[model samples]
Every structure is written in structure tokens, then in C-alpha cells.
Target: MATPAAYDGLISHAGSLFWIQSGEGPDQLVTWTASDGVSLAAPQGFELGNEIHAYGGGAVTASASGVWGVSSKDGRIYRLTSDKAEPLTGHTGDQLGDLVVRGETVLALREGTNGDQLVDVDTSTGHVRVLLQSSSFLSSPRPGPGYVAWLSWDADHMPWDSTQLWVARYDDRSGGSLGTALLVAGGHSESVLEPQWGPDGSLYFMSDRTGWLNLYRWDGERTYAVAPMAADCAAAPWELGYRSYTPLENRKIAMRARRDLEDHLLLVDESGHSETFQLPFTAIKPYLCTIDNAVAMIAATPTTAPAVVLVERDGSYAVIAGQEPSQDEVRQPERHSADGIDFLLHPPIDAETTWRAPVIVRAHPGPTDEISLRRDPQLDFFTRHGFAVADVDYRGSTGHGRAFRSSLYGNWGSYDVEDCAAVARHLITLGITLAGEVFICGSSAGGYTALRAATTTGPFRAASARSPIIDPKRWEASVPRFQRAHATALATGATAVSSAAIECPVLLVHGLHDPITSAQDTAALASDLKTRGADHELLMLDTSSHTLAAPDLAAQVLDAELRFFRRMLDQSESAKRT
Candidate 1:
């Protein structure tokens, strides 16, 4: 029962670290100081979460003065004190998130049924005023001395696919209204993210103008490339408040560059001279904030769990939230490349004691996501049970250039499926797995790929899909507005998986309350499989979300998956013996 606690949304203000913690209990906002250590910022019964985009981030913001966050129970902004939680907004039915503080205003991105709006909440009066509201989506509403910068995109594009960086002057004459806006950078092909105001009053942002997301500086009049590199310095803006880099003291920049499927921390100077700093972590989250001369991030190693680490200039760090787990006898990944696709192959733990172990081919979700060499408890569970796991970074994965990621724009189903199958075949050729013992599993988009592979490909003996998208077009219609465009793009050439074509034993597990993928569609697929007499089992969890992040539910899922795979393996072995 490995219920590893989860940490996210790391930020620093006035030498105090604030982050969101879950899994130990209800999700809570935690504040850490050198003097007081770690303590809950909210009351004991209060849970903090942001639901702006369905998949929320940047739910809380803090400074030396006070701490403010959006409550998960009610999608309203709340100001937290020592023991009291006061709601600042009425029951407007609008979700507020991506919280930031500037002057005396708490700026947040408000998502309502009408659309998205960038608004400011007065710290003293709790007055909500719309700063700008025309784009279909808005994020990162950063307020500076005399200007406000944010990222906006239309309904036809995801923030990563395309976005525009805009800045507007603040007119204090009429109680501080945003004046005429200026298009600083970004267009249809260019994606911009993390607009931060530097100490020198220049706006710093990450843009993929040259097909690689690099650092740039905007001095109001013109934009200049600060440190241009082939590697991407930003991630897909799946959630708000994503910061890949932060401007430090003396015009210096601390950033995480994704290269070779891992994150490397680098320091960029005023002259664009970059230096790499070695650290114990290989995977870094999409949040970075500066504390004094050091940077705080949610980072992890291949063997250690994810933690809120305050990293110094010389690459040394101290844990702020989660502690570093033990590294004893951890199974390291064997990086492999097959057909220009990258994957991390983890052999069964104690492989010497096993004979012809089965292999699990994992298709990562997002279909646009990448799998780093981080410590994954699920992967460890499979390997410890005599199962080799192949964590495939199929096409459309980030960290690679924009071309590689957008290659699946209209070819999502085919390209990603082919890549995963190619990795399994490559493993078979290397004698790491047997041909008849290959299994495939995925969640969300990856689950769709697993179902497609089991139906089309022969090497796979069993398949597992959790909250899978049985019908792409249907999914596009059911998903939130923020993901509708991206889903439509990915489902351009993909059709629904036909249950009648499934021959291999399949396991379907879906959370009834999954917000992203359609749970009703999964149930329909289960019914279809049953009618067709397909060998399958459907495990419907009553209270799990998309990831089944709960400890007990996650454990149940892992145990069920292992049992299903082993049953198939035993049946195959018995047939061979007969």
C-alpha cells in the first residue's frame, strides 16, 4: 500500500514557500518558513483547489502580507488568516485561479459559462473588476508597475499550439483601467508562456518562435531573444500558473531546459551566457520561483520521490515539503530508441529470479505527454511483480522540438499506436520480452492507443484501458472548452475503437467521476464488449477521478491490473503446454 503524497504548485514570496499537498489527507495549502517549518495555511477542514480549466493549477498565491487561495469545496476566492477562511466573492458560479498579487490587487483568471476573463480582486474591498475579456481563454494575468501582461488564445488553438502575448497600460485616472493593448509577440504558429516582469521592468517570457521554446525579453518597444537554444525551456500550458523559469537578482535567469527526456537546470546571464548546474533531480515540474538567490521547484530523481526543493546557485538543494525517498536497489531505466521514438525500459526487479517475464507496454496519456526517468510507484509495482515495463514516449511528446510534437496533429491514433508497437517489437528483438507475452495499457489518450493496438496489432496478448476515449469525436464534444480544440485536432484522423474487433483479453477500468474522458462512453464500450463476447472485465470505481489519485483506489487498480495480466499469462502458458 504505497500511498506516496503528492506535491504541486510551488511558489515563494518573502522567504516563505507555499505549495499544494494531497494524498496524506484532503488537499490543503501548506506554508513553510525557516522559522516555523511546515504548517497549513488554511484551517484543518478547509481544502484548497482550483477548477478554472477543469484541470486546474496556480490555485493559491501568497506574499509577506497574507495568503489567498480558491477553495475546492466552492469555486470562490478566499482570504486565509490564522484560523478563519473568508470568501471574497459571491456565489457567481465562476471559477477563479492562477492567483497573483501586485500592488494591493489579487489578479486571477476567472472562467465562467460566458467565457474567460482576466480580472482583478481588490485585497481590501473584495471588488471584482474585469481587466480584459474578449479572448476565448486567458492565463497568467501578471501585473507589474504600470502594465499587465497575459497569454491569450482563440478557440481554435491550445496555448501550446498557439497563443498571443499581450500587454496593456494601466490608466490610473479612471480608478486604474487597462488602456489600449499591444501585441508584444506570438501568433498562430508561435506559442508563448510564463510572462514574468523582470527586476528591470522588462517583460520576460518563453516563446517557441524558432520552433523551440526559448527565453525572450520584451522592453515594451521590441522583443529580443535572450537565450535561444534548441531545447524547450517551457512545457505545454495544460494548467495555469506554470512557470519554467524565474528572473533572479542582478538580471540573472534560472530555468529548466528539457533535453534528452530529462530536465536540466541552467542559469542564464545578462549577456545570454548560459551555464548548467548539476543537481540530484532529473525531472522538474512546470513551476519555478525564486527565494533569495535560490530557486524553488517541485523536482525529483529517478529513485527519489518528488519534493519541494529549494535549489541554490551551485545546484545544492534542501527539501521543503516531501522528503527524498531511499535510493536502495532502485531499478534504473535503460534508455532505448526505436524507429526514431524514445522509451525507458525497466527490467523486472530481480530479473535473475524470473524466467521469461511478461512485458507491459505503457502508452503515456496526453498523447502529447513525455515520460521522464522519474520515480513512478506504478512502474515499480509492475516490475516488482516480475513484469518488465516499457515507458514509451511516443510521437507528439514534448521536450522534443515543435515539429516532433505537432507531427501527430492529424495523425494521433495511427502515429502513436505505431510508435508503441514498434517499441514492443524492438524489445522482443532484444530478447527482453517474449513475443506472446506482450501487454499494453494506458489512460486517457494513451488508453485509446492501447485499445487500438490490441485490436490492430498481434503481438499484444492483453490490453488495459483506464478512462479511455472510446470515441474521439464524442470525447471532443464532452470535454471542457479549454480542451475541445486540442481534442478536435488530435481526433482529426482518428475514429472510435470497434469493440467487435478486439480479440485479445482486455481490462477496462474507468472512474465514474472522471471529468476529462467520458465515463458514460467507457460504460458503453464495456456493454459492447460484453455483447460481442470479448474477453474483458470492467472495473467501475464509484469515486475516483481521472488519475485515481486516492491511495486505496490506486492500490486496487494496480492489484486488479496485475491479476488480469497474470491470468492471461497463465492461460497462454497452459495452452502452450497442452
Candidate 2:
């Protein structure tokens, strides 16, 4: 019963509904009662989490003059009302986030050091007002009824590799300002996203011009696509109100796409007709919220785990909050077709196993991210311990489009270390496991693709990596000068594989306040694998970060990575009986 902390801002107002449960501590803000669920902020030293573009979503939003969020200890912009939450932007170093509110003003998305604009605060004198600056990165500002749409993108694109969708004109006669924005769709090589205004004001978005990521509608001068399909109704904005579609009730829409990696739920209608709806989820979160024809969403189901649901147009859905993962602790993955590689295998929850189980694989940390058949209790704790997970959606991932997500752009650590050694040689050519029992884990660009798959592979008999990036040229000197040109276009020309070309046993784990991969780059690659003697073993957690969000330091870093993969599979079965 202790597994509920995976729900995000699922808004809806006037009918009363809100979400955000940042798991366990700080970043709560619940609210929904017909049987229970309240919280509304503060239950452990304030935090609503929103670091803006450092992977912070449209942290909390709801209107009628209440609930606005973004605090995670001073990135500013609060306003909870009735239950008291305060601080409406004093600009404590200006970070703010993708909020919206309007009608007392909120608009947000600031980020500082002179980049990312579209301001507006002032819910009563917290005064801010920039309204729109040239973008290098800005995001969904979305105001309506006089115009104020948003989303920019440059610095060589990565809001799914391209974005634009402007549209200004929001005046409020002098005290608001925002007029010359224009550029409707997106720049060439499409990738627009979530603009939204509808109910006759017409604008709605999510593009990817024919290469997937569908749904469109403009009406200020004609655009209309509404539902195209190849799959991928949005994702890869990496933050900011990531909704795949919304705008129901008589104009009907409620989307959510993605293909081979699951997630369905369509419902178009308004004369365009679209239907797909066989519920039991497969990962559906991109903020839907609507309440009148009922929509709301937070879904999940590879054996269920995330829940906030609501849906109703006769598809009948309810959950309203989380919890649902017991079918003997659910495992369900099976989808390994190979070819250009797209994974998800999970076998071994206890299939009368006598041996042959040690598998792992994993690798997902946005080397441009992707891997969502949802409910991952750390890949079900490696198939309930007997181990057999695979989960890689490699080749730059992201619901597979944009030429398989630009094939890992400058080849991030060589196409995610050859898609984790082609899913460990298609899971040992389908016999499922063998070849030194396979292993390879990842964290943070999949810990630099599990230390670049232990230096160009031996089909991994040992490798764990969290917080890795041992040295993509010294990790592009800690990127963030507006993402050092996307970390120099994903580590320009790749090739850095070292740790002395690892031959086996390596564990590494890091998190001494990982502000984006740096526990001294896993203590200088465990001090150069202890000056070349190699056979690694680092650890170091001192109160984890880089999303290890503490659940007893993520079960002591998964019990020190299942005791370093069972002492490297018992020293490879004691070197095969000597």
C-alpha cells in the first residue's frame, strides 16, 4: 500500500479538480472529494516543484483566482488561496514556469540569465510584465480571447527538435502589452505543439507535419488536420504543460496517441470522426483536464499504477486518484520485434525458473528519452528479482518519429551504444538469455548509455552507471549555458568511450546533489577505474538527487543495484567452473 506518488498537474476548474502529487514529500496540491483526497499544499515543508526547463512541467495551475504553484524552495510564483500558499512572484532569481491563469494575470515561463521570456505575473502587484521576448527557448504561454499563444524554439531545436507557433495581440489596453507575435504553425521540418484555445476561438495544435505527432486546427486563416495518425500525439517538449490534446464538449477532441510503445485513447468527433478506446491504459499523461463532458486523465497500465482518470462520454472511466498494481505485482511487457529495434520484454516474474534469468538491459534517460508502457516500479524491481527486463526504445527514442528521433542526433554515445547492444543481441537471439547472462542499466542519459555499454560492448556481463556521462569531452563542461547548444549537438562526433575499455564488473551510482550528472562524473570514473586496475564499484549517495527522489534513497539505490548484479553473477559462475 505504499506506492502512490506519480500523478501530475491534471487540472480542471469551475467544476473543481486539480492534481500534482510529486510523490512522497514536497510538491503535493491535490484536491478532489466525493469520497476523499485533499492535500492542497504543505504537508512537509512546502514544494510544488517547478524548476522551469530544467525538466519542470507546467507546475500546478487552476483558476477562478486560486491555486498557481512553482516553489520547490524559491524558484518563485506561488498563490494557493483559501488554504494559504502565498509568494506570488518576487522573482527570487526568476525561474518561474509554464503556468497560464490569465484574468488577474499569471502567464509565466521566465527562466533567467537573459533567455526564455513571455512574462506577465502581477496577481495583485507581484508585478512582472515582459510579455514576450525573442526566443531561444520559451514555452506554452497560452492566454486567449485577444490572443497570446506561445512556444518558441531555437538554439538548433529540441522541443521535439523544432517549434514555433506564435500569435500575439493581447493588449488589455496598455497595462498588458503583447502584439507582434504572428508565425502560426512552426518553422519548416515541423514540430509545433500544444497551443490550444478552441470553443470557437479556434487555434488548437500539436503538429510534426505528417511525420506523426498529429492533431491540428487553426481557423484564423485555415489549418485543420484534427487527427491524422501514424502515431505520436505529442511528447518531447520535455516539460511545460505537456498535453497531447484537450478541448471537448461539442467540439470534441480528447486525444493521446503514440503507437508501438502503447498509449491509445482517441475520441475526435465534431464531424471528423475518430474512435479508438479500449481502456486499461498504457500510459496516458500529457495533461488533459476538461470537466463537463468529463476528461481529466493521468492514466497508466502495464498492469496499472498511475491513476487520476475520469473520462466519460460513455467510455466510462473513474479512478480519480492513484493505486492499482497487484496482479501478483504485475509484469506484462512482451513486444520485442527487433528489426530497427524497439523493446520491452520483462519476462521472469517467476515462470518456474530454475536458471537462465539474469537479463536487465534498461537504458532510458532521454539520450532523447522513450520507454513508456508505464507502471515501472523500477522495472518491477527487475521482474520481481529473478530479473529479465529489457525496456529500451533506443535510437533517440520519443514515440518514434522525426526519423526515429533524429537517430540520436550527433549519435549520442554511438546511438545509445548501438541500442544497448541491439537489446542484448535481441535477447540472445530469442532463447531469451545467455552470453554471460547480460546486464547494463542506466540513469542520466541512461548513465551515458551505461558507460557507453561498457565501452563498445562484450554484450554486457556487468555495468550499472547511474548519473553517468563519464566524459563526453568532460561532459561538455557541465552544459546549461542554455544547454551548451544542446550539449554541442549531442556530443559532437561522439567517440569518447573509456574507463579503459571496460571488460566487465562496473557499478558506479552517483548523486551527491546531482545538478545534472556530476558526482564528480562518478568520482572521475571511479578514479579512472582505480588507475586501470578496473573491476569498478563506486556508490556514493549522500542524499541523492538527479531525480532519485529519496524513497529511502530509492531503496538504497535498489539495494546497491541488486548487490551489484549478484556479485557479477557470482563471478560469472565462478569463471565457468575454472
Candidate 3:
């Protein structure tokens, strides 16, 4: 009913039930159904928040006897009971943070927006307990009801060198007195990410201890690696990103993993047996779910995003749930037929509401062969702001197989640039975009290509990029700890076309916290742009990793881009009017 809601996490009660909020809805959305999958309804007037990095942060806080939906929006515990849904915790001024429910009592744990204090409020008696009120911050609870698992933090919030996992048990009827908190798991070079309980009472989580998001299980005694993925398992970390699972127990635990390096799902059993399959869709999550050891899961294929696919123990597939976006809602870019190769043209959502939208042609990072419209939030944000962004599945992005994806091979800067120009040329001919008004941009590998096109083959006047993976030689020697080896993957074979190819009036945003590409590398590149006499400005976001922080920071980068295009293309009025 809305413009594509991202169903990141899933849980089941008596019948197949889930909690969902619209992708563009506010933070406090409540669209849950009964246990029977009947009566799918959303709470009136309460929309889900579109804040930064809080996917699946809220949950259904139900007890064994009675169930209630809970959330930490506006510092209040908005609940859905047998009658009308209302606030269960907090008076009028207090804001509730992250909380869970046990039996009859609801414990709403609140730490101020910036202050450091854990305020535990009881849902039944309205009693409050200040648990270790400190000046430091506590990260979101790692979600388990009876076993309340939380991570400790100090003032810095810069990630603890050695953080410990703390768990506590409590009965609401007695008192909000959380049982003795004890450190159950700790002492790792890596941080503890999303922890889920298996059907058999084991704690399952993903850690980069081995440089990849691998599966690990923990009882009270020790944590063991459930399944070890390939070395390239994580191109990045699990910080605010994702992985998948819905365990009945640790034994019959079902999980979806990133295999072959993209967002594909895999099936894993307790014995550590693993089977890789093509997810129904590359974008939506493919979760392996089960009950009482008999398995069922909602998976997607390349054809669709997360159509609920249940797996039988005997290994048969069944599509049980979830909705697919209508073809019209999913803006499929027109395929431009040129040079015996057909390219997909993806338009932004804002294009549908208005006409003559400013089209930005983009070159993807990977030059692997295929036709793909990789769903990216950044891209969506562009559309959300009312720009028609068109990305090229030109000669190289992967999915069509290796041949198409690897077309650029050693010629990264040159070939992808050509594709960008070609897409622009085709779009102009198709009459979707004006030739002079189209803008081009990309990041890392794609950034290089965008700037290259702006100078050499393309007519676009402005360019924007994020933490570009420029100067292969410089990048290789001084990359981040996790991506030292991935430098070679930038090209198929090796060598050639220089950075001199990228000469556009560029707006560059780099992250100082970039461990992947050195901040020095970004500065050096910017200086080189000046020496080469290109009209360029470089701004860096503090404490931000490559993706940067959310909301305000991301808006700044984009607004700068808006100004860049407006100045050069002379389309501010057109941009404004649209």
C-alpha cells in the first residue's frame, strides 16, 4: 500500500505474524497482524520513523500470558492491548529508549537522547529504577526477553577495545528489580552484533572475529563457531548493516548468508551443514524460519525481493508469504539498445510525480557482467528529494554472469566512463532527459568513472562522489585493515589509464573515519585536483566511516551536490519547481 516497506527482521508467535513499518514512514509505525496472520493492521496515527540506522530496533513485547506491541518513539511506550493501544511507560515528559517485556510487567529502558542513564520503568506499577546511571552511553539491548542481553559502554562511544555482554533475568510482578547482571560472553577482538536465540536455547550471533560475518553459538559455557564463511565474507562490517536467521533452536537454526559476496541467502543446519541457493530476490532478506524443528522460511529470488519461501526438512521449497512491488511501482529503467548490448535505465521515484526530472546517470562500482538495479538507500534518497536518477547496468555490473560484469576488466576508468556517456546519449534520444541537464556521480570505483566521464566523453557539467577509491597504486599500499587485499579486485588484470581522466567541477565528500581508503589519500587526491586545475571542493565528515553518519550529515553531502548541479546546469528553478 505504501512505497515499498523494508521488512528487515521477522518473528512469529502462534500464527505467522510480523512487525512492519513503511520505508518512508515515521519511526513509530505499528502494522502487525494477529497470530493467525489474519487482521493485518497498523496502529492509527502512529507511523514508523525514518531515522538513521534503526532497522528492526523495535519488537513485539508480549508475555507468555498476554502479548503487547512496544516501541521507544517519542520517549513513550506506545502499546497495543485488547482495547485501544496506548502508552504503558513514561509520564508526559520522559522519553523511552529501547525496552522489552517479560510476563505482566513491561520494563522500558530509557537513556536520554544524549545523557547516560538507564531508566527502567515498570509497565504495571509505574515504578522506576535507575540502573547504573552513568555519564556513558549504553548501546541498544541485544534483544532477548527472559535473558535481557546488553552491551556496556563508557564515555567515548568510539567502540570499546574490549566490551562485555551482560545478561539479567527479572519477573515484573515481584519488582522491576533486574536479577543479578552477569557477563556471560566477552573478550574478543571484534564487537558483538545482532544476537538471536535459537529454538534450543542457544545464543546465535555474527562476528567479524575472523574478518567475515560468520555464525557463532553460545550456551552458558562457551561460544562455538557455527559456520565459517569465505574470507571475503564481509566486504565491510556488521555495523548497522545486516545478516539473516530465525532459529527454532540452535540445532535446527535456519539462516540466510551472503554467499559469492552479494546479498544472497544460504541454508544452514545445526550440524554445520550448509547449502547455498539463489535467493528469490537479490534485495529482500531470505530468512530461514522454523517451529518445533520443522522448518519454514520467507526467502526471495532474483526475480522477486523476499517472497516468503518455506523449506521442508526433505528439502522442498514453498512460497508462503510477503508481497511483491507492482511493476509500475518499481521504476525499471528503460533498456537502451546500443553496440549490441542492452542497458537498463533506472529512474528515481520522484520522477513519477513530476515531469522532466533531472536525470543523473551513474556508473556502478563493479564491472562484472549483468543487468541489475541494486537497491541503494542513497539512490532512493536522491529520488526521495525529487531527482530522476538513472544508473547504467552497462557493460560491467555483475548478475548477467561474469562476461558482462567483467567487460571493463583492466580498463576501469575508460570503459565505465564510456557506458555513462552512452547511457546519457541514449536517454537524451529517448527524450526522458535533456542532454545538458543530466548529472553524473558515483563512489569509490564508480566515482572514478563518473569524474572521468565528466571530463572526457560526457557532456554532464557537474560531478559528486564519496570516499573515492582513486589511484590504485596509492590505495593498495595504504588501505584499511579489512580491505588490504581487495585493491586488486578493483581491476580484472591490471594497470593503465590515469586519474587525469577525471576532470569535472566536482563536489567530493570523504570520511575521516575511513579505514578502507586513507583520509590522507582523499586529501592527496583533492590537492592533485587543484594542481591539475579542476574546479573542485572536498569536505570531510568527522567520526564517519565511509558511508558517513545518518540524517543531517547525509543531507549535507546531498545538498552540496544539489548546489553543484544547480550552479553548473542552471537548473535550480527547474529543480525547485519540480
Candidate 4:
């Protein structure tokens, strides 16, 4: 079966629901209503995306006038209507993202080589005005009655590492400008995200002041926690326009609280009283908004695909978009913990013959990214091929609070490598996997972990890394300006891998156009492997980027890894017979 279409940036305006759907072609703006079901917000061929902060989001916003979107082809905002699309922002070198409608103006973050600025675009005349400018990067420009609030941070820090929320009086009467501002929250040690305006006029946001991202509100003069739960109410701001919660009527807040890598729907109040609802979906995407007295969001489960879901007051939810796979097509995992690391262990689909089956230990990318209970097609493919898959959510993963997320700060290579090795050893002790049949694989940061583990005295029989970072110091120097410091921080004590130390079979697949990780460095490592006569293969793709945009190429890479593992297993058996 084909992978399901992806949905994101869910929002509601004037009783109509709007979101972005991808995986079919270009990311298209979709609108759904009770009467009309689901339809495209803009005509086909008019794609929507943004490049602000390098990873763009919050590209579409709707007002009474019409819908507005940022063009992925060109860095410009387009007013998307049913009949035609028009450019609202001028064709400049600047890129605008995180579009939010306030009054007659659309507030967005204008990113340029100079710096980032908060700009306002007039919906009526398509005129643009600069509201606020900062040397630091800016995002989530939330405009209230007479004030504008947004997130700002220095180049040395990622948004999740450190951020500041500032609010200033904005006047768009003549040409937009900002007055004296007040620092609402966030500092060097504290990370804040998703500042939004409530119906009560209070500014709401998520802060990790108490070691977890919880709901907090600023009533102009004072700031307090709306919900003081231990669960995190937000994820890292990898993209803009991610709303973790929505303010509802009667002082109620519908929040997607993440705990243990799973998202739970919670209804919280100002008094800190909260109620949890049982839902079919275990994973919920950002940008939750109110619709007809209920909450609407993009959510998924192990048996279902990510869809635009309208969750009602009674806890019943209806999928407005996307489809669900058959029960036989997906398999759930058993939660396993080793050395404080959480991992999902999926036995082979044909469990009856998995007694001596080989195990695939997989590491998720981001190093900060977590593995949820959502259905993944790759896992299905591996399990179907009589392989037990273990998805490790090692230290530094999200959903466990800030302290755990920051645990890998100075020990990126060490912590991730040890944690992945620990999971494999634990499986061996449990008799779930054999020592010589266990393999580790990952991409990007996770790939770094796999390479490091393979060099160590671990149980990993072989290793596969796709576009892996072999040299942290080199990777830190070549990454984007916004993430340069982040890379340096992650590479604090990381050492470059030695090709001579890798004894087992290795498979390396890299895209030539990967901007984050250097393909040249990967090529250099491949040369070293060849000089040492190590059993390895390096597959290079000319058309793909960091993320393989082509589905067939991704499948080809997966099949290549499977073949590499099977060939190694056969070699081991032959050696034993000899």
C-alpha cells in the first residue's frame, strides 16, 4: 500500500477549516466545511510552502477577504481565491512565512540575509509595511488588538534551545511600526514557543520554565501557568505555525499534551483543572484550533493515517481528510526501556517463525525527534520480510521534558551511541534477537549514532547510514546560519569516526544535493573504506536532497539496505560452516 497523504498547518476561520495536504504532488491548501465536506482552497498547480527559518511553515491563512499562501517556487505571498491567485507581497530577495491574519493586515516573518523582520501585508490593496525589525531571527508574529507578539532568538541558539517572547504596541494607521516593547517571558535557559492571542485578550504561550513545556498566559502585567501539568504542551519549533493548543469558550483550553512520545488530548481551564479524553489517535500534529465549539487537528494512530480530525465536545472525532489502512497492513509495537532509553519493538509480522529472526535496530533522525505510535510503511516492509524492528527513542528525544531533551547537549555522539547499543544488548539479553544478526541503521544524526556504535565494541553486526555525518566539526561549519551554532553545540565532545575502526559490513547512501550533511565528506569516508578493503557499498543519488523527494528512490535505498543485511548474514553462516 502507498503511504498516506500528509496534512499540516490546521486552522479555522469563519467556521471553515483550512489545512495543507501533501504526498500527492505539491503541498496544496485544502478547506473543509460541514456542508461542503472537503475541497481545495486554491486551484491545482498553485502550491503552498515557505522558506523562512530554512524550514518553513504557517504558509496559509484565511480572512473574510479570502485565503493567502506563500509560493514554494518563489519567496512571495499570494492571495489565493477560488478563481485566481495574486501575489500580495513584492518579488524581493526576502522570504515571508508564518502568515497570520489580523484585522485587514496579514502578519508574517520577513527573512532575509540581513536579518528577520515582522511585516504586515494589507489584504485590500496588497500593500506591505514593516512592523518590527530585529537582528535576531523572528517568528510566530501574533497580532492582537493594539499589540503584536512574536518569538525572537539569537543566531547562536535554536528556538528550542533559547527564545524570548516580546510584545509591543503596533500602529498600522499610517505605515506599520512598533512602540516600546515588553519582554513577556523566556530567557537563555528557558525556551518558549507558539505565542497566541486568546478571546479574553490575554497572550497565551508555552514555556519550559518548570523543566516541561506547560501552558502559560500573560495578562499584560502578570504571567502565570494555565496548566501546570508535567506533560509537555509543545514540541521543538522545527517549523513555524505549530499551535499545540487552542483557547476555547468559557476559559477552556484544548491542548495536545505530549508524554512518553504519545499525544494526549486534554481540556484545561484557567484554574488548572484538566480532563483527559480517550481518542483513537495517539499522535497529533500542531496547530489545533476551535471549530464549532470543538477542537480540530491533524492526528494519527498505529492503524490510521494522519488526517484532519474534528474532535467534538463529547470526545468523538470524525476524520475530515485522509484514509486508514487495513488492520492487517499495520503492526503495533511493544514499548521497551533500557538504560532509561525508550524504544518500540515490533516483532516480525509472521511471529511464528521469528524465534531466530534477525533484528533491525533503527534510530530516528533529528537526534531530537521522537518516535510515536503512528503507522510507518517502512516498519511494515521490514516486519513483512521476517525482520524484527526496534525503533529507539534514545536520550535527547522530545516528549520527556526539557531536562531529558537537553541531556545530550555536551555528549551527542557518546549518549546517542551508547543508548542505541544498550537497546540492542537488552534485546539480546531478552532473547528477542541474536548477537551476530543485530544490525543498526539511521539517517542524519541518527546515522551518526549508528556509525559510532559500529566502531565500538557493541552487539551491532553491521551498520547502514544514509547521508550520515562522519565528521561533526565539518558538518557544523557547513550547516545553515540558523543551525550553525546548534550543530556546534551538538558536536561538543563528538569525535570523527575512523574508517579503520569499522569492522562490520557498512552501507552508505547519500544524496548529492544534501545541504545539511556534506556528501563530499561521505565520499571521503567511502574512499577510506575502499582503501582499507572493508565490506561496504556507497550509493549516490543525483536527484535527491537531504530528504529523498522521490518515493521510488527511497524504496530503492531501503531495498539496498535489506540486501546488504541479507548478504552479510549469509556470509556469517558460510564462515561458521567453514
The C-alpha TM-scores of every prediction are 0.97, 0.35, 0.56, 0.97
lDDT against true structure, model 4: 0.85
User: Residue by residue across 1-578, what tens digits does model 3's lDDT show?
Assistant: 22334453344444444444334434332323324443433355453321212222334444443444444355455556433566655544434434445455554444444544444555665567665454454444543546666655444222212345677774445545567888755444454555566656677775555545467888867888887765222222112223256564345555655433234445577667876554334443433345434444444332244444445555555554556423444454444555544555556664654366667776655333223434455556666655677656566554333244435546677667776777677767767777667888877667666656656756676777777766676765675322333455554444422346565577778888776556666677678788988778898888545655345566778777777777766654566568
**Tens digit of lDDT per residue, candidate 2, span 1-578?**
35557777677777777777766665567778544556554334567776676777787777877778888777887787545778877755767777878787788888777678888876888888887676478788888888888978887657776788989888534685777778988885888988889878998888888787888888888888877777888787777787777888788888888888988888896566899777778888788878776788888888767888787878878786676534555657688766678888877777553335779888888666678887677777767888888888888788877788876768888777777787798778767788888988888778777877787646888888877777676666775645555667788887665677877778888888777767876887789889988888898888537867456777878888998898888888999999
Residue pairs clashing in model 2 are: 243-286, 366-369, 443-447
Per-residue lDDT over 1-578 for candidate 1, one digit per residue giving the tens place of the 0 to 100 score: 26567888888888888888887578877888889999888887787887788788888998654889888888888889659999887778788899998767788899988789988887778888888886598998887768889888998899998999989886322466788889999899999999999999999999998999999998878888998899988988788889999989889999999988789999998688999988878899988999887999998888777888888888787887776745656677778999999888887777763345689999989877889778888888998898989889888988898998999888977898899889988988878788888999999999999998878856898999988999998899889988999999998988788888787888999899888888888888889989988889999999748977577788889999999999998998999999
Q: Please report the TM-score between candidate 3 and the true structure.
A: 0.56
lDDT of 4 by residue, 512-538 (tens): 888778888888888999999998899
Q: State, as a TM-score between 0 and 1, how close model 1 is to the true structure.
A: 0.97
- Please state the error at residue 256 of candidate 1 in Å: 0.7
After superposing candidate 4 on the true structure, give the runs of residues whose Cα lies further than 4 Å from its correct spot.
174-176, 324-326, 353-356
Per-candidate clashes come to 0, 3, 30, 1
Find the 10 residues in a row with the least total lDDT in model 2: 35-44
Residue 185 of model 1 has an lDDT of: 91
What does candidate 2 score in Cα RMSD to the true structure? 20.9
Compute the lDDT of residue 156 as modeled in candidate 3. Answer: 28
State in Å the error of residue 554, model 2. Answer: 29
Each prediction's Cα lDDT score? 0.86, 0.77, 0.54, 0.85
Q: Indicate the worst ten consecutive residues by lDDT in candidate 4.
A: 323-332
